[model samples]
Target: MTDAPVRTDPSERMCPSTPKANATVFLGMITPAGRVAYVTPPLAAEVALAGLPDPTEATESRYRLAGPCVTSSCGFWTGDHCGLGERLVASYQETGVPDEAALPRCAIRRTCRWYAEQGPAACPACSHVVTDAR
Candidate 1:
């Protein structure tokens, strides 16, 4: 296998789908510790056969589910800049999350656009970013 890291678009990052069919890569469902884990195609097929329900859809919790990989053409993007990343950093600062001192050890860092644009400061609030959380 090539040693080069996978490069993902900011608009295309997504949580893994349950019964994660054909998912070769996954971001773990947790806090700053979440790491992108790789799954082989055969293993993904086996998981699909097990009839697992999507955790995020099945509950009214703040946590996320491992589901299909998807993308969001966020309104925040402007001329290669990420407004959402800026907002995330701002929110952390406003709430005293102490974002600047550290960043989560994320698996998607190499491929993440926000990390590329905003640097490590965006990771602390990254986990709390759920689609339509409002």
Candidate 2:
């Protein structure tokens, strides 16, 4: 079988170093309660609306973004960076380790400016525990 595509550098992705003037899609912010608080960039809201389960339930939490930012070299970033790792850590602390393998694969994984440039090991937002996709 072919190996899953590897993303070696995030800097090569299409992430903008600055936020777009009219770009309305933002990443979702993970709350301390382990609930994803929809904020910024309307796209985040849309994803949250469609993807997130009821916050009141105790099921495994899904992945959520903290909002688009130029934290990596993306044009979507403002000066304020979305600390995905810290937020995720907090979420895990409050909620518990998520079923990382069960979580849907991020579409941006291949071209994610962060994963490409920084590598997965450096990502504070990603879970260190890996499970077989199969």
Clashes of 1: 5
**TM-scores for every candidate against the unseen true structure:** 0.48, 0.29
| Poorest 10 consecutive residues by lDDT, candidate 1 | 36-45
Q: What is the C-alpha lDDT profile of model 1 across 1-134, one tens digit per residue? A: 22233334555643322223323333344334443222222122223323336433422132333332333443555655666767877787644444544554444555455666666666666666653333
Sequence-dependent TM-score of model 2: 0.29
Give the true-structure RMSD of model 2: 12.1
Residue range 21-48, candidate 2, lDDT tens digits = 3122323343566534433222433333
lDDT of each: 0.44, 0.36
